[model samples]
Target: MSLSVTKKRSLAALAAACLASVALPATPALAQKVKNKTPAAEASASSVDYVVTIPSVEAVQSSMDEATITDILSGNLAGNAAALAELDATSITIPEITVTLDVEVDGETERGTLTLSNLVLEDVSDGVATSMRLNGSSFATPEGNADMGTISAENVNLAAILGIYGLVDAGASREMQTLYTDFLVGGGSFSSDEFSCDIGAISGGEVRGRPFETSFVEIISIAQSMEDNPEDISPELLGKFVRMYADLLTAFESSEFTFDGLDCAGTTDEGEALAISVAGITMAGMSPGIYPQLSFDGLSIVADDGTMALENFTLKQFDLSSVIATLEAAPELVEESWFEANGRGLIPAFEGFSFSGLSMDIEDQDNEGERIIADVAEFDLSLGQYLNGIPSALDTWARGLRVDLPEDSEDEQVQQLLALGITTIDAGFRIAAAWNADTNTIDVEEVSMSGVDLASVALKGTIANATEALFSLDMDEAMTAGMGMAVKALSVDVVDSGLSDIVLAVVSAEQKVDPKTLRPVFAGLAEGTVVGMMAGVADAAKLGSALSSFIAGKAKSLNISVEAKDDPGLSLEDFMMAEDDPTTLLGKVNIDASAK
Candidate 1:
């Protein structure tokens, strides 16, 4: 049996418990009710336990003649809400207890034990208990065992859990209902024959589950009882389950949770030791339109021959307000025809996501000693002001992306590149844009890629007459939209910090000459070529002068821009046709050029 299953069965057994004849401690408020008297001392004539004979709920039935309870009924399964309402005590406490379950594993039955210390159910009001707690908890099975420091829950919906809602005013139903305000689990550990884990504290708050009015446990019981053909489910059954999904954002509107740390160690199939560790994960501020911010600072995977590590990761501003709103407007979308009507439209608004300091190192002995390694400083994407599930503004970038090339390479190109002190393409890249739906225009703010000690070239432009038809699937419609767009403004800017000088050096090295001697020689050749190519242009000499100065290393930057004279400036189709004729294209627009 899995550790999770053992935990559930063991806890369920204690939930349907053993009554001890002893006085138990209570809070200051309930202290008056528990004045050194036994738990049943105040038990009215209405007190009764009806769910006396369920399988996992029966603790001592497997090894002994009966459970730890004082009495046993032969054939009842669960109690009704009416029976639950008869309880009059402010609290119910049980001594340290142990429950054994007959676990099924590999078609055979084995033993699992769940031990809980000093369990308490307090602040009974209506048909619910306001809180529940246990000092310590542990679950043990043949496969593995887990021990926890403490377990507790506050504002627990006891009525729903005890099957009170299974039968409602109308009669029996299947709508599942569960709600709780806060839940906490202290440090814990799990160990098996080949693997072991150490888990830190966990916490949850403002948790809302399925909004259905039915009982949660009964739904599980029905699902478990189904033998075969479970996939051949009815639409009504599917709809009921789907409606239960709509309440998630509405449930965790103000919920927050955290995981402190987890460290697990095991072995690979070849018996090589491997371990995984994660720490400092927190999530907060989850609501309909706002996604919870989740972040972690430490994570790593280590093996005998390799390791992977990350400094931090964070994701936030994933908004599902539109999806939730769409469902509320047409709850029928969750029914049998979900895919056609609703599933395709479930795009969440992405606001931001990022990670930092990622590194990987792997040495594979099976692949002739080949190694795979990488280091990335940061990567991020951010967007805002969504329209029709599209972000109106977006910015994304990747910085310091790097990977090494082997020194002993088979390819001649690799050897030549390495001979020039070039290894990996350690570079950064960025692209940013904004769309104005009201104006039918898009502004590409910036697009650039830059390498270490290399050149940076950026392009920015504005396009007008961009319409919703551009988002269509039909090729003809999209093509028509593209043809209709006009260039409002465009510019290219280049910053050659060292790329030009390095290229000159490479050429000089091949020719056995000094790079300083080639600068002016190459510059004059470039200028003469440019003027010859544009002999008939009005600004040929001026453009040639700037190009020559830039190549001679006398100028480190070059810029060029094209701007429309008026509205409906230059259509892309017209620009493409006239692109080969510089004189005609220049006559249609204003050109700006400079070098510095």
Candidate 2:
């Protein structure tokens, strides 16, 4: 089984499940209702294999985004602003839209191709099974360092998979419908069954950071269900589900979501070695009742040297219970919220919903100035777990969320880089929330690195310059319980230092450098402008310049006392409560870096 095939099945089932969950009127009943008016009947339905070709996939995507997706049942805009925006943004420009499905629910398979030039409302509103096939796609930049070229898929199937439209009025139908199809690719010879294997490379676009050589095989399967299956389903529910599925498909087809370099060495028009690859894969899907799990295996991205860049690059496991939960709960939540907010209204008032628990790993190497920089980065993530709840209500009030973090609990690759002279190494930044509504907030706890080798660097003009200074900070919490609303509290402390060449040369061997660990110790001793100017970006020169001014102002009154006894340090309990509800604790924090 291939990851692509698995995704196909996973997505197909997902689409089916999503569609089935949204209740809709019987297809025949709705069709008859709109047939009374002759012009409406002709305009509202058609049985042509709908095919639309764009100059490029982007054009198709652009069109999807810009066009208003009317409610096929009601012919109204559906009052779904987000839906409108999403569809408007994903218009794709495909080379051709071919409908080649001939089914009779009997024992015979008939087939023919339907060419679609212009995609209008009538075709979709007719409830026809339209399959779309993508042949080629291209993306380029002027200088082209970041250019991706040539994406082609032959005889692609896109019937209900793409979605059908009905044209009546806004309040006519409260649901949408979809048909499902699965595409399979093989090399030896086309299979008699819809899904059978062939020996050949997958034919598609060339993505960077992926290996697509060795005659690897490719397959694409699709299946769909209507949005009118659940009992008492409404338009609001239908719209939300369709929008979610559409967004998922759009993401899978997007630059950010697609893996790069299937043939890792493919060249651009201007010619630069492609940096990634993931091809020669197979895909499939299966449903087992309550929840569906799609697994991928035998997936690899090989480099020019025959080395597998993604040796273990496979969907080893996937547990979508939370995702399933969200899908099931969203409609109910939307309906309840809408009615509560607007008095039994059917308008889709989309609150927010998200699925968390996702984990994956990738192993690869890239040519850094001189080294291959070989290693693996992995992560295990749970949305509602790691981030119990952020410090803001806005974070929780979102429509969707996704997160990608460093998979390796111990990011050895980064540590290896830091060990080398890569002082500015890119650390694995943890990704938690991917909220789609309003303000989105991400968190970065701290960076880890070894600091021993950097003890001798010197600043040309500052005070007795210091050398190696390795520091790490521990945060208590970014969010916590307050008097009422969610509250946020953060604490940062710095430690660790080694002498620079200048400082080492000036101090006597008998004088230990540890005592001078505090940079503020020297700054505190200063008298004038220095103390007042310490709240911004600081450099040795700036500190030096401000010292004299700081010494002049508070030198006499400066207090420098340290208590040897430990008494729980200092308490700012008075300031904690005010973090969220300012009326209670007062939004203030006491500064106490000193331990005595």
Candidate 3:
């Protein structure tokens, strides 16, 4: 049935009842019929009913005073007393409101359908406002979840949120007053399921605020203002505010957050305008620790008319439960004691980290220079249980780590280095180490690098008393407790003919220097001269010349070894601070050199 026809019939029935009351007088037959129909049966007969109204701001405000409105908007009255009280105390106005509800009854079931054509909240003292509209909203029976359809909102200012919580301050700047979210359109359904509620993707929307140097500073400033006033604020609530500020600071200080698949722009406090848009952003397993597992996918940044981007970046596996727990317990903390207790309490625990497919291309518009591009294929760092009072190990490796040099390089130093057999350099390094608490030692199982080797080289060593020296924080004692401190072997195998010739050329050039001519200059110095007294140069020169000739003529592949003699362990302090001849410090150690 048409709504207009239903409305006409209702009005006609009311006119008939009025005429009967005046002319026919009250009849027992009419009263019997009215009493015969039950309220539910009567409502059922009417089936679908529609009500349309344009409610004024004052009317809306008065309606919010109703218990049902108050309960629905501000949870339960008992637990949300503060919110209810705030609602009653604050002055709110709606410039325009149009609501349409189509309520229907079938058997014992009742359903409500709502469509909002326009909604505007204005006349706020803080100059904040909002406008929203919804189409085809449906309510489930028995006060169940509402299913929203194509909802849109505009001019959702931050001040409105603050004002709702009674946090609006008149002294705040316009920037703080004017910061707002742009138009957003989304739809979602609320149901009785864990994490099932989903707000559909936003096609396009942005939240903007006054360009402050940092969000941390701005939030802290607002918190400080509230602290100074202390009106209507409980100590516990204040502590919570401080705690949130501290968490924000800690997160910003510790982690690198990457954003992708977002359209963003902002102005810095220094008045520099910046803008960036990306395909998407992924920050995986971020935590407040020294080693946080994080990742970014398809990231891009636009700056100074140029772009820097990465395909994927990741840091793997670390626990941040301690940090989160500390932050969550802020409300129970004593006021004015938060900073003192947590300022230096950060301890990081991490498992692994990695990076891959990073690239950058930058252009200097001001200088009209060529675009500079650089790329990296992969980089990774991994750790196994360190510093948690557990046995720990570490492994790191990298591949295809290179930089693209400009065809016409601008820097003279870079060009010079490239000229000397260094072009489009590729390099990689690998390190593996383990800590043994039982033996109090750190065993470096392997340390190797490529692209800087005349021959394949590997270094293996152990730091004796590693646990005590590192964890005990007593350098002097650790230096004097050296034990079993000797290199087991030192060897190198020439793998490239060109690198072998370079080594031979360097040694032969050194041998060609006239040792006799170099000896006289040191020999002519007096016994008390600065050079003679400082280094014993006259006696060292003769020994150095003989050793140089021996190395140049006999050394094909070099090896060296040192064993602790039958004496006390070497004292690092004595070796560094000794004022006597340098060789005197080596008297307590044995040395061997060989060439084969």
Q: Compared with the true structure, what per-residue lDDT tens digits does model 3 show for residues 1-596? A: 01111121232222222221111111101110111123444442333333323343332443144333222221122233323223321333323222232333344434443333323333322233344333324443344454544443455443333432223332333232222333333444555322123334233233333322223224444444463345555566566565564454333211233332444555445655555544544444223333344555666676665677777767675555445555556666345566456532333346666777777777845436777666667777777654422226888877666766655777887785455445565556678888777976667776766554434344555544455444322445545444333232222222231344444444446768554344344324422242333353233344343334333433334333333344333445545545665666444444444344
Clashing pairs in 1: 175-214
Give all candidate RMSDs, comma-separated. Answer: 10.5, 21.1, 21.2
Question: What do the candidate models score in CA lDDT, each in turn?
Answer: 0.63, 0.27, 0.43
Better of 1 and 2 by TM-score: 1
**How many backbone clashes does every candidate have?**
1, 90, 4
Cα shift from native, residue 135, model 2 (Å): 24
Instruction: Rank the models by lDDT, top first.
Output: 1, 3, 2
Per-residue lDDT tens digits of candidate 2, residues 46-156?
121111222222233233332332221122222332243223222333233222323222334333333332222211212221233333222211222111122222222
TM-score to native of every candidate shown: 0.75, 0.28, 0.44
Which sections of candidate 1 miss by over 4 Å?
1-90, 96-111, 123-131, 153-183, 204-241, 289-291, 329-338, 364-368, 388-392, 410-416, 472-486, 535-542, 564-589
Candidate 3 lDDT (Cα, 0 to 1): 0.43
Best by TM-score: 1
lDDT of model 2 at position 104 = 24
lDDT of candidate model 1 versus the reference = 0.63
Q: What is the lDDT of residue 170 in candidate 3?
A: 20
